[model samples]
Target: MTFQYIAQRFERSGSGSDSFKALFKSAFDLMKEDTANASLYFLIAVAAKSYVRTYEDQAVTEEVAERAKTILCGYNTRVLEALAAEPAARYAIGSGIAYDYEWQVADF
Candidate 1:
């Protein structure tokens, strides 16, 4: 799956980037080496890092930043595995090119 896909999913989940970054940090030391698990974690790591940039929070440690990238790359093969699983269910139509779809369907 693309960054957009995971971003869309979590973004639509109404999760904060701070939450995502913290979750990834907490989960970082414990992710399984198994391909699927690793891949999802990698997605989470990358998403956490990328999403953090959009926030107004104070800068994170270079250590944290490096750790995020390292964890994601350690599972590179797994990340690629996830990337092969599916595409974005929907595409965005405007700026940022970020995934912004609503996860729930509602009668309007």
Candidate 2:
């Protein structure tokens, strides 16, 4: 699934519900299981960070948000820097290419 599609699924699954952690966990697990999709999964986790921020008034706690941010920081600095350099690249899900069209991760 594309990042957009997966993000939409996260929204449809209920943003502030208890399922957020589960969904985020699932995405993280997918990252661990599929190395080729690491970038995509990382983006999903980044989206989760944004999600947590967007819905901070809901069930998502500060601890969970902090954990998400911490995990994102665990990624290779060079890779993150490379991705940061090409914010407008096209990322195809399952293609093993780390690119996302106009996806701004600056806040990340």
How displaced is residue 54 in candidate 2, in Å? 4.5
Model 2: per-residue lDDT, tens digit, 51-98? 555665656565655554443333322333443454443242212222
What candidate 1 gets wrong by more than 4 Å, as runs, is: 1-17, 32-36, 58-108
lDDT of each: 0.41, 0.46
Query: For candidate 2, what is the TM-score?
Result: 0.41
Off by over 4 Å in 2: 1-12, 58-108
By summed lDDT, the worst window of 10 consecutive residues in model 2 runs over: 92-101
**Per-candidate TM-score against the hidden true structure:** 0.32, 0.41
Judged by whole-model lDDT over C-alpha atoms, candidate 2 comes out at 0.46
